[model samples]
Target chain A: MAQHSLEVIVENSPGVLARVAGLFSRRAYNIERLSVGPTSNPETSKMEIVVNLEGHALEQVIAQLDKLINVISIKEIVPNAAKAIVHDTQPDYQN
Target chain B: MSQMNGASSLVASLEAAGVDVMFGIPGGAILPAYDPIFSSSIRHILVRHEQGAGHAATGYAQVTGRVGVCIATSGPGATNLVTPLADAAMDSVPVVAITGQVPSVAIGTDAFQEADIRGITMPFAKHNYLVTDPADIPRAIAEAFHIASTGRPGPVLVDIAKDALQKLTEFNYPNSVSLKGYQPKLSADAQSILDAAALIAASSKPVFYVGGGVIKANASRELLELAQLLGAPVVTTLMARGAFPDSHPLHLGMPGMHGTVAAVTALQKADLLITLGARFDDRVTGKLSSFAVNAKVIHADVDPAEIGKNRFVDVPVLGDLKFTIAALIPALKVALAKNRPDLTPWLRQMNSLKAAYPLGYDTPKDGSLSPQYVIERLGKISGPDTIFASGVGQHQMWASQFISYENPRTWLNSGGLGTMGYAVPAAMGAKVGAPDTTVWAIDGDGCFQMTNQELTTCALNNIPIKVAIINNESLGMVRQWQTLFYEGRYSNTSLESKRIPNFPMLAEAMGCVGLSCDRPEDVDATIEKAMSINNQPVVVDFRVNRDAMVWPMVAAGTSNDEIMIARETAPDWDSQEL
Candidate 1:
């Protein structure tokens, strides 16, 4: 299983948060991190969900979540395998 | 246009949206909304409880294909509406629940009767809105009804703060709704339809697995046309009980746990399964791996999310079932003309299995009545279009097995949620929606205690629906589970016979006509008498054998091979009770 981060755009109506949270709980999907915020558009909200699942299961979860009436679109954020370069200007503590 | 306050605007929105009646209770917080209903065109029925109001709305929606509206106040009233909202969500029933909330200023301060109803109902409703501004009332209501009745129909909630209702604002109802993110899939792809048709034409062993979506889509006629064109047997799931006529030669009855042997075998042996608006629910699919293993499945539903949620599909056609099935009829006929699979052998086998294991129950030498016999006789006596609602457990199973449903929307029940107190309130809603039809709530003794207060609602509103309580004096389904799986522990399950507040007496106390019939000979006559009463609601308590259990059972989490027939389970049942 691998952790995948997904961004979901849905109608900014009351209870859309609960509906998303409920889908995770009822379907027994593992949620690592979840957050919701208003989009530039006043009528829509954006949700970020990090979940751990293998290939087919993740695809099914995404499909089911997309089926929700209020949900408009979903985008999976690909992981960056490349490491950030670190500056070694200071000497080691032991030295 | 006349100037209207938030309360007037709310009531006007309901009236403008074509809502004829609503079910709910008035409270201090929601008093503003209630005050205007007196002068408004919409009728309001005062319910004994808020939960009854919710379920009544569900019942109304289930029968009429309309968005049922319900009202309740904040805090306790809001919490009470939760169950019905969850029930509606699970069953995909269309309903709009409106509740009064604490004033915006005192919302988080925990004022009197203050509760976050919008947050509480978020998980269950299709969507919810909290209107703190009176100007948003008309638009919010229009959107709510649209959301509730659209694609995969479900409940929606709108919680208006008291301050919003108190504020004066000019009412301007929106003619159309424009929600940026709430678009439903309204059309299907032609390639998937043609591919599904191809699969159907190539398979000798084919079955049309129908469900509630077909009924919700109002595609029963389309379903029948397709079933006949395909020359395949049709097996409806519990929720789809009346979607297809039970008396049709190609109809194999209900499938899954507690379903008929023919229906189960047909689904098990089918080479191509055309699943129309039916989800592959755990109850319907005993073991996902083993269910229709050989069949190439075609899953057609309005909601794209349900396409591959459970079962892997060869063709996932997403659109409304009524339109899809109607389209599929001509496509299938064309395919058949070119190449048709010989289904004569498949038809013969289905008929033989049905004849061999036809649903049977013994007429006991003793005078005690059999619940199955009572239901079968009730079915025989009632009209073809007679409406029947059922509570959860063995009685629900028995009703599905014995009663013959010839038309859609005639059979209503809590299928997905398995709610116990559903029938009483749901039947009341059905009665209100179709006043000309005879509505009967076939309930269990244990289930009746959950929501029988609706009898007062029925009596007061002059809804002359009938109720039959199969009073076996125990939680039959739970007791059966304990008997088979828990080594007969029985604990806290049986509501012993001769208990206080007997159903008949309880019915009478609630202002409904009550009748009790313990003898098998009096079963038909009692139903006849109850049916004759058209002025007020009637409740009949049929004292059934306590040890009787629903057979053809597939124990939970088990495979198709684990189904226990009647004779195989008879010896162990009631062994500990004796």
Candidate 2:
């Protein structure tokens, strides 16, 4: 199955990450790439959540994340795009 | 691109990430970074040694549940940090190590104090960065912090070439980093939760084996609720010392090496071992084949690698601890309330077993201070909020036994690595993390002498941490092993003539008050006096009995049932009386 990358923006808080990640886990979606950091604004953080799933399942994962309270937006950043160059450059070797 | 010093941009990025402190020891290679450290708002604590700095950062990260930042120079300084970085990695503590490397021009030419630190620390670090260009500094710092503090938190290293730090570049720090293959599984399936609940409900003897993940995921409330509802006895790992209230009826102290007999026995007897946020480390499960052999394991952890790494898991739920626990709580509550399994009989049996192999110590009639008594008294006087940071050895075990840590992040120790001299610096970090809480550094004479120089750092920062030293006049743990297993061969275990500097005198030299207690009666008074002084650090040398050994110890490679309780029973002591 092809891996799909989804970027989620949420409020930087204690349990927000857990909730957002919980959404995909409930559906049994395998998260392939997940990155979270502060956005330009301090109050919010952009989470780049990538999961390996069929195209149809990927769409549902994005939609489910968008439904969260603190979630501002959910974008499917192409997994092979230049934006993911950092991860591609250094293969995640540690298992 | 606008021109800005790489060091300045690095500092800006760190500050942007809300990092307020940098613990390190400066050297020639890192002079540029040190310059910015002084001008910037972020505070710098110059540790006596680079290793202490890394551990201090770990201590800070563990207590605050934030990414700790530490810096060091090239070669030796960076090498010193390797142990602490490895220690942090082993414990899954979030720490970021920023080290200055030799200039780009001198990279492979064997420049002065040059070392392949990035290569050295690759296995130990979650991820590492080597900044050859000035422009990469900003992105590297941001990514380093992100990698360190994120899912299944661990240490990350960023090696900046000295030339890069000195060079100027555009100060644009990347607001975000996109990485592939680093996805942290953060959610538990609803069905998995149901399955876990079913197992919990079906099993008559269920036990919750918790680790540092409980604190990391902030799932204490959920863990407590599940345990209470199911009436399952909870045994916390050494790293998860304070995850559950030590005084709770279900709290079966720490389980692993030096774990209480009751707790380890419970693990063995449990039909269902619902491991939440705990990896069955070898120390905790001495021989994996014999560990919880009869139990149906339900492992719930954020890290997927830990699922079947040690023991076979009947049900593996890969998700954040809080979410998994939250999902399981409702199901467990319903199942427990409906079925109402009479766990009272099992609990009574466990209590009986605990009573049979009770952890106790004898007060010498010849009038010598006991480390156990001192720690117990300290525990009694201190509030639940008081934090206990400990150094390795018998004193650490004593502190683990006597100290009743009720809250998560309240107890910090080098549990996985068992690094000596971890207490004082770690306590400094804990005090920094939680300024209002009473932080105590419980150290042994042998361990205290290893990093006592950090007292200057505490004094400089005016961080008032009370340090209680259990002076046994020998390396108590090793000596005990030698006495028991080696037929008292004695060889190098005796610390006689090691001549530790009088702690009180050394404390005075470091601009702090110090006290010494020789008599058992003076322990309370000494601790009180030390705690009262809030302005500066205080060190108390507690002259404990030399031959004191932590009892109820399970010999290595032995089953949990093989525990050595106290040699003799005292008139005042009765396990059932409590």
The numbered model that scores best in lDDT is: 1
Candidate 2 per-residue lDDT, tens place, B1-578, comes to 56878888778878988899879989999889888789888989888899889888988998899999899999999999998899898889999999999999999999999998877875457767778898988888888887787778899899999999988888887878765435566778888888888888888888899999999898899888878878878999988988999889888787876787778878988898999888887668865657787889999988765776566678989899988998898888777776767777779867776666556788977888888999998988877888899999999988988888898998888888889988988888888888888999999888888888888999988788889988887889999888878988878866651256787888889977888998988888888888899999999988888888877666677655555564332212244332
Model 2 steric clash pairs: none
Highest-scoring model, TM-score? 1
TM-score of 2: 0.84
lDDT of 1 by residue, B1-578 (tens): 67888999999999989999999998977889998998988989899999999999999998899999899999999999999999999999999999999888998998999888887876567888889999999999999999999899999999999999999998999999877667777667888778888888898999999989999999999888888877799999999988999999999899988888778878888898899989988888887667776888899998877776767778889998878987788788888899998999899888877776677777766768888899998888986789999999999999998999999999999998888999999999999999999999999988899999999989988998899999889999999988888989999997974475677888889899999998988988999999899999999999998778887877777665556677355222222111
DockQ of 1: 0.15
Provide a comma-separated list of chain B TM-scores, one per candidate: 0.97, 0.96
- Encode model 2's per-residue lDDT on A4-90: one tens digit a residue: 677777777545676666656655667788889998988788888767764334545664564343466677767563332111111
